[model samples]
Target: MKIIILGAGQVGGTLAENLVGEKNEITVVDCDTSCLRELQDRFDLQVVEGYGSHPDVLEKAGAEDADMLIAVTSSDEINMTACQVAYSLFHTPTKIARIRSPNYLKYKEKLFQSQDVPVDYLIAPEQLVTNYIRRLVECPGALQVMEFADGKASLVAVKAYYGGSLVGHALSTLREHMPHIDTRVAAIFRRGRPIRPQGTTIIEADDEVFFIADTKHIRTVMSELQRLEKTYQKIIIVGGGNVGLGLAQALEKSHPSVKLIERNPQRAEYVASELAKATVFCGDASDQELLSEENVEQTDLFIAVTDDDEANIMSAMLAKRMGAAKVMVLIQRGAYVDLVQGGDIDIAISPQQATISSLLTHVRRGDIVNVYSLRRGAAEAIEAIAHGDSSTSKVVGRMISEIKLPPGTTIGAVVRGEEVLIAHDDTRIEQDDHVILFLVDKKYITDVERLFEPSPFFFF
Candidate 1:
């Protein structure tokens, strides 16, 4: 695939790095010479130094024959305009834009259609991060929660605790513990190394276990690997930015004890007026006095989502130090995310990963509906629809045991219409079944895509 990415920022750089290794021709455009040079040094891709929305710049970046044009520049306007230019001038087949502002997103349904901005797909990092954090808030003790099959089934990651019922047991014992409830252990990482799960494999304490089950049964399965945590209340959010406000709005109805702290008094007041239940404070989130007044020691969850990575990390560290039970920070830089994770911060939220997943779903072949980048892009949890008959499709009529899944890949579950069935050896995939799979290694993603796609010889 030949692609033009309209930014050399975190999202663009990450996307370039991911696709460059996958046999795709990637060209990045940006105004910053230093940023473009950095990406050029790291990846084997072309770089155009100019305003991405400019027509000449798109032509210089090979947008004419590009398979996709991804506009993820810092400015929403630039991204939106770049997509319009790509569609109007180059006639690019696919155009994806990263739109952060909630105001524009409010009118997105009517705005981004072909008749208007012509953006084929819109990637809302703020909204995606909001949903990501909301899932973590809803399912306590989970390192990550990725929903699939329209929220009917979810893939959850949790650390195996020492005293958990299934911590020292073989994978087969999970069925014994919950005979009535079916679930699949997708993959396990022991000390940061992938471990392909098998029925005989014993789960050790401290291992990161990824499992798939019905969304309602998520907590029940979580308890088997680790002790269940107390439900969150008294949530404090730092920054009045889009992500912070969006999260506050989403949590307000369910959690009335939500508090939002914004350093800017005006934005804080606006947020206060918008939210009926959440308490809004116009003060520095890192201020000891302000946090003390709010009783940070008793706060169940403290989130720092300021635009600045340094500010978010520092404030979240202070919150954790001040005795917040759990602290989640929204960090964009990949380096910062690695540094903060497994330290003071409980979860380092990365919008880049979420954005990448959204983009990959569109880039991937066949009928993949949803994709979640797991374990920092090394793994992937995908939801794909099975199509065609026995002769036409590689997966449609095959049983779990009969299918040739890529190495380290595991079929987790299948959502057939309204039913969520945990994938078993005898489980057979039928047409239109939404198959959820976990791949410990995504290098064979092409094979997975081919498995879902109908044979080339088949007629439409």
Candidate 2:
């Protein structure tokens, strides 16, 4: 696949790194010569330094016959225009643009069309990150939560607590603990090492457990692995930028006691006006006095989303020290994410990862509709639809046990229409069933995609 990425920034670079070794031809375009040089030195891909949205840059980056044009440049106008140019001039098959501004998204369905902006997909990282954190807050105790099958089913990651019913028990006993609730333990990680879940596998304390079930049954399933935390009410957010403001807007209705701290007075005023329930204040978030005045001790969740990594870390740490029940820091540096988790910060999330996951879903082949990166791309949770029939597909019309899944991969759940069925040995997949699978090793993703691909004789 020949792909042109219109940015050399973090998200674009990371996306290139991910796709370079995946048997795809990657070309990156950017104005920063240093960034292009850095990417070229690290990966086997072509890089062109110039204005990303420019027609000349697009052509130089191979837009004429490119399979996909991913415009993730920082500027929303540039990204959108690049998509327009790709479609209007080069006729790129798939044009994905990272549009951060919500103003344009308000008219997305009407504006982004073959006769308009021509973006096949819109990757809004801020909105994606906001949704990610919202899910974590709603599903307490989950390290991560990703919705699939149009929110009918979800994949949740939670750490095993000592007192939970299934903490020390074998995986087979999950049914006994919650007889009516159907769920599947997808994969487990112990001390950063992947563990393929089995009937006899015992869930140890501190083990990271990934499971999939109906969205409504998620909390019930989580309760068996760890005691459910109380619903969060009071929340504190630092940063008045896109992600922070977006998160405040999304959570303010449910969590009425939301407060946001912003260093810029103008942005704070904008946030204050945009949100009805959330209180917005202008102050230095890392200031101990400012946090104290905002009642940090009573805060249920403290989130630092400032653009500066060190500042976010400092503010979140200060809030955690001041008695915030949980602290989640939005760190931009990939290296800092692994460093901050399990310490002062309760959770660490990267907007790049969310953007990458969204892009990868569209980039992937076959019937894959959703793809989530877990444990920093070592693992993946995929939601793919089964197509064709017994003789036309590898997975359709086959039992869960009969499918030749890659090693360390597990069938987590199957979503059929509105019903969520937890995967089991005897569960047979039918055409159009949304199959949710977890792979501890992402190298097996191609195999999974191939398994779901329809034969040459069949078409969706």
Candidate 3:
């Protein structure tokens, strides 16, 4: 970890192309000499050209043996003055920054401890793409959520349509139709990686599962997979910029029934005077007759946060071929999120891979409290927490096939107390458990934090 990124754009060249092959030591900076000669002909880093908030260019981009200094400069005061001069003259031990001013994330922790601007972390890909479209408009059929720690383990993402009834169900018969539900069906991105379902992993109608629960049983696995869609009362949003004006001012201050559309008629009258009860629609969202003359097939949810990724994947596949039903696409090109999740895009949100997975989980804070980079980053679900002089006390109650993990890491769930195990090998991991591992090498994330060593809150 000797990072040092500073804006080469597109979230610092997608966080130096996903920290290249992770043994760290990156270095990027850039006053665009052809984006530092196209990131030095594509990665083997150390690019540095100039002006990453000057000071002799953060001391020639080394920033005093930088262990992490990010600052994604699309100028929020030059990424908070290049992470406050690399944390006040190169004391850079994880400085982060990115802040796109929604009034600097509304007083972000008293401006990071009263402007001691050594921004330990601040990122705001328009508030992480409007908190990832307000967790898919507050779970209106949950096609992806992921929250961990603060909410305590969760990973939602559903989508099995046709006659729903848990389509051809399996994975242990949908756990005997929720016998006191303690969810798990961990991975199943079908035509992608993360599978391990077996018991005839059926459930395929529109198939895009990923459950792993216990954020209070995630509404009992979205009410036993009928794909719960109660709330979201009409919400269209095709792109007015800044993640569609911060998701139409966060669904018009959480009142929903919003609309937006904006194909720049002065940014649709500045998002209709900053979302005056949404419904802006100034024109051309790749006009399928103006998205069926603005009914987008009776929208229930069709967020396609514009800044053109082929007009947010062709207006979210024309609001999922005009039926809407739920279609989210914000693709800030993380390699086109697998070509708009191989079409039919029902949840693509990338905002530069969610601000480089919140700046590599805040430069890998102590024993990783969170870290997502799923599918395309091949794997890394993380969340960790176990400490208690962690070595995970030699497999706390051992079973995960008798604990010798580390192959491409797995232990998908295990929150303990509020129960959410999903992990097999007779599920155990006790002491303050928060587990959630998925890993596929980030250098074995400190050997999966020494098999979950003693961690009782010590976030860097």
Error in Å for residue 81 of model 2:
2.2
The order by descending lDDT is: 1, 2, 3
Top candidate, metric TM-score: 1
Backbone collision count in every prediction? 0, 0, 11
List candidate 2 segments past 4 Å from native. Answer: 457-460
Residue-level lDDT for 201 in candidate 3? 79
Tell me the RMSD of model 1 versus the true structure: 1.6
Q: Report the candidate with higher lDDT, 1 versus 3.
A: 1
TM-score of each: 0.97, 0.96, 0.37
Error of 3 at 240 (Å): 1.7
lDDT, candidate 1, equals: 0.91
Off by over 4 Å in 3: 1-75, 78-84, 87-90, 99-124, 127-140, 147-154, 157-210, 213-224, 227-236, 245-260, 268-292, 297-300, 304-360, 363-422, 427-460
Q: For candidate 1, lDDT tens digit of each residue in 61-106? A: 9988999999999999999999999999999999999998888999
Question: Scored by CA lDDT, what does every candidate get?
Answer: 0.91, 0.90, 0.73
Candidate 1: stretches off by over 4 Å = 456-460
